[model samples]
Target: MKDVLPYFLFFIFVENVLDLFFEEDLSWNDSFTSVATGIVSKTWDLLLAGSFIAAFEYAGTCYMWNNYRLLDYATDNKLASFLCFLMVDIAFYIDHRLTHEVSILWLGHVQHHSAEKFNLIGNLRLSFLKIYRTWTYLIPMGLVFPPQMLFFHLQANNIYQFFLHCKYVPKLGPIEWIFNTPSHHRVHHARNPKYIDMNYGGVLIIWDRILGTFVEEDEECFYGLVHPVNSNDPTWIQLHYIYDMYLKWKQQTTWSHKFQSLLKGPGWRPGSPRLGFIAEIPEPVKGDSKTRIDPPVASSLNLYVVVHCVMVIGSVFVFMTKYEKDNTNKVLALYLLLCYLSITILGRIYDRKKYAYGVELFRLLFLVAFTWTNEGSMVQFLRSICVASSGFMITKIMEPPESILVRA
Candidate 1:
């Protein structure tokens, strides 16, 4: 995961520029929020790794079937690798399908579908709780392969899936029938009736076809959830679906009905609504005018915010690349806190909040002091101070009249 961070960052930058040049219907705020959420999620994963690994080991050992070793004959290097990759892909397909069909699991997946745009950044808008939900699927693979091999295949599967998030790739004529291409994954991300619950394979499209869940991309795709998340706040994006489930559960009168609300599909309801969360699929729309929130920002303030975002990205890259695995907890915690602060402040700026500049100023100062004291890196300290100073000066110079600012 650490090794792939730089590549992910570079691809996102390239895609954003291409979107601008081609005038694609992209949401800048949504893209930024997606990337920020990914950073937070990656940090959280590092923090949770030890506990998750222990649980995985316990489960795998307890479930290992000594008598029925299926892959015993496939011990050749190439054969073992191929078998592991195939098994992992199947596991991902089942895990993804269950997340959509089951209500509680959907809480861990809805955020990925909340973005109205289908760019590379949108692919990173994943659920932080996903690790908890998908770990069990890999336990079966432990019976056939060693843990190290299983881990390698799992990472390879993930890397392959990342390329499927792009929009510029057209459908491959013959390969589309065997492998999961960009076109197939696009249908999976669509909110249309025909596209929902289809194409769950990670690397291979054969699983979808064999299981009768494949849907061809015949028409234009409408991305995002049917019930859009209007706000760009990362915290709200993470918790909103779970909160909605809680409220729905509270409304139920019987215990069985309440449990069903948690176990059934996201569209599932108790009494009158027989649609079961899969309501009538609306026709495809042109622009995402309803969900996109692009508040007017002054050119100077926009530059300041963009520059600050780049700094945050750089900080994240450094943290991921340099931090040693043994003593990462403290640094990871502080890094995650800083990331959350930066994202919240950016959301405020997107909303045109008057106090956002003050919050950002404090964040920059805190970051500089924290880095200087912990690592004693003079170069990083000076760089952060310079960025903060530039931002402060720009905000002061572009400040609106005091009377107008006070009215808000």
Candidate 2:
């Protein structure tokens, strides 16, 4: 996982450049939010080495060890391997569908759809809360395939899905009929009334076609949720929908409606069907009249945030590569604290909050204090950069510059 982190970072960099060349409307703030969320989620996963295996593989290993195998054949066989892969894809289809259809589950998934611009970084914008939920659907498949094979196929399915998040790809004529293409997935991400809850397949569109959830890409997609999360804060992005659901649950007068508010589809009303009535879904407002939640940011602030974010990412790499496993709890906890603080400060800066400057000063002070005692070349380097950045921020704040301190 540590080795592959750099590659994912590179992919985001490449996508950013590509979007720039294509003159695509891109939001660096949203992209940073995705990266920050991923850093926390993936870093935690790395901290717990067994996190990649997670519940799905653990259950599969237990079942396989007990000789409760369904297939009873090794994955070395080509046909068997293909079959196992197919089963995993089917598992993803079921898991993906449930996340969309169930209201409570959608809260765990809403962050992925919260990105107004559909881009590759959007793939990294996954919910940490949604990570463990897949085992519920994938565990049953464990009866057939071994844990290793299940892990491999799941990763492959994810890799395939990652490419599906891009915008430049046009509809492939032949592949569109069977496999989940970029076009198919754009519909999946869209909040358009016609496209909502459609194309839930991970790698294969056949499951959705047969199951009747598939919708063809006929028009340009208006990406993101109908009710957008108008903030870039990773913490808020993760919690907003869950809080929204809680409010929805409280609004219901009857006990059954309260429970149903959570269990039913996101758009469900008192008299709607299990997945809600389509007629009730409003036709999405389109074109220039519709705007995304992007606040204007000064170029200098963009450079500041970008440079520090790269350092935050470098800190994760340094911890992973240099630090030992033993006696890491204290160090890891502090690292996590700085990470969250960094994310919050950066997010607030992008959102143009009045308190962001104060929070930035606090975070810099916190970093200075931690790095003062810590040993290592990387630690020293980080301390120097933090000090320099702090000095720069202080100068700007003292100026009371319109771009830095005084804002709308």
Candidate 3:
């Protein structure tokens, strides 16, 4: 699986390129943000994979029922694989549904749905905190299956889910009834009243059908949260909902009400104008008004940002592949810093913030200083040159018109 990581990345990149360039189904900023978030999520996954595996091993060894331990039985029996897969699918369905229904859980799950555009890149917009809670859901399965089997099946489920984020695939005639396809999963991502909280299955759709949580694709799906995130900042995308819940908790007059605000469904609030379950549908906002800032930027600047983002992403891949256990802390810190600076600078650029160029300059200077202290590789020098030149171009292009500047 480690060896095949590049292939997986390539497949996702190709799909995104086809969708953005050929299909024209996504916006440049939306796609860029989604891809950036996905890259950040993958970076965290690489940094934390060892810790999660250790935790899983410990839990499975200590927590399983003695007589019910199915490791030997499952290993010897070919049928056990299918049974274990079924168990994981069911576990994911329940966990995914609960995340939507419980406000606290929603805090960790909301980032995955914050994107207004549905594309393969959106699949990468996962929450970092999700690693902590998602393992808990698999603990029950640990009671039966071994930790190894549980981990394998969990990855299988997720890999199947990756391809489900696209809009290119239409409803498969018979397969749609059994497996969770692109069409069915689209309903899960939508905020439409008819589609909200439906189709929670990871690999199988039968759980949703049997449980009466399934809704067939009908009306055009509007992708995103009830209230659009409207910003491309990855930090804000992950934390805004948690902050909103905290604020809501603060507004409560009593402790119990405060707990309710934190634990209740997203629609729940205190007092009059309380919304019923079905009536909690979000009022539609005009699409044009969804974006808060849209300053005109040169096409060359936009292309530069995209190219620089790709370079950062490739650098991350190289770092992860060559990362060593001995220097794990140093490598992880530098990698995360690079990714953070890249995304933050790109987000500021997309919003046309006047300070974007300044931040980009600072980031380039930091990179140069860091390189100078090390080997001062030619690759680093060339990258710094490209980034600085692009930043200068963007700064000049985004300058206000002379008349507006004079009035100010």
Candidate 4:
């Protein structure tokens, strides 16, 4: 059997390319930030959470094998496969819905909705700090089915959901009844009070329909949170909601109120129930009043950011592929450091922070010196270009166009 990784990657490339032709407001800066944040998020999974989850699943699998042997035919029977897939889908629905209803869980999920525009790349904007609730929720399935089978279906479900993030796909007439279509997903991502907390499904819409969480899309879907993050900085996007919750916790008068403030729904108040009052939800910004959260940066800087983003993504690809075989701590640490600094610096540059110029200059000098110390014709060539590009970027940073440098 062929690996799903290649097809998944190819689909991402095609989605991004098609998005340029099909979608409006194709902000290159926002897209670059998505890719950078995605790199960091995936790296976090690989270095930490991935191993823990695998170990837990493996232990569960062994326990099931040694004890009941009830689901021994899971890998062979078609009925077993179908059941496993259904179970995974249901688990996803529960996890997605709970994340929206619970305040603490929302902290991990808010990053996905932070983007103002809904496009294919929007799927790439994930929270690096997001706690893994899906895997734990699938524990009952783990008690019966094999981990390999469950893992395959979980990945398959995710790949299917990836296509739902875009706006290009039209409503699929009859299929919309039972399956989760892109149109249904658009309503789920919207912050409009009418659509909030609706259509929480992975592969099938039957759960939402049966549970009374379904709503038909009758108007233009507005994307993003009720209160927008208004930033492209990955760090800020990841922690801002958590910080807000902390402040809310501090403002409460009693212990019960403080605990409820953090544990209840994001819209919850002292007098409100666990899910909070609907009146607390902000009205969606409509028509001309609605504005996206894009900051200004020079064209030269845009090109620079895009080029470096591609390089950083390529580096991540190399690191992940070699991760199992490469045991050198120093090499791994250096790789991680480079990826983090590259994106953080580029994000600050996009935000047009004055300190970005100085930090970037320091990074360039370090690269040039590091490359000089290494012995290779290619290394020397790279060092030479680094010197020239460093000078060019310095000039661009020092004298940005008056029009492009204006803050939003």
Candidate 1 lands at a TM-score of 0.84
TM-score, per-candidate, Cα-based: 0.84, 0.90, 0.86, 0.90
Task: Report the Cα RMSD per candidate.
Answer: 4.1, 3.0, 4.0, 2.8
By TM-score, the better pick of 3 and 4 is: 4
Q: Distance (Å) between predicted and true CA of 110, model 1?
A: 1.5
lDDT per residue for candidate 4 within 97-151, as digits (tens), equals 9888989999888888877777667787787654465546555566677767777
Per-residue alpha-carbon lDDT of model 3 for 307-392, expressed as tens digits?
A: 77877877776676677344446876677668777776887777666676667767766666666655547676655666577567
Backbone-clash count (model 1)? 1
User: lDDT tens string, model 2, 1-408?
Assistant: 445656766876787888888944556777788877777665555454435657445765667635777666666777867987898898888878888889998877887888877888888777777656776656666677777777788888888888898788898999888999999999999877899899999889999999999999998788878777888777788779878998888899999999999998898879878888877765665552136666557777888888988888777766655653543457765675577668767887777775777779878877899669888897788789888888877765665435653245
lDDT of 1: 0.74
Q: What is the lDDT of residue 92 in candidate 3?
A: 89
Best by the lDDT measure: 2
Residue pairs in candidate 2 whose N, alpha carbon or C atoms collide under 3 angstroms: none
Q: Taking the tens digit of each residue's C-alpha lDDT, what string does model 1 give over 135-231?
A: 5656666678766667788888888888899988898899998999999999999988878888999999999999999999999888888777777
- Report residue 164 deviation for candidate 4 (angstroms): 1.2
Among all windows of 10 consecutive residues in model 2, the one with the lowest summed lDDT is: 399-408
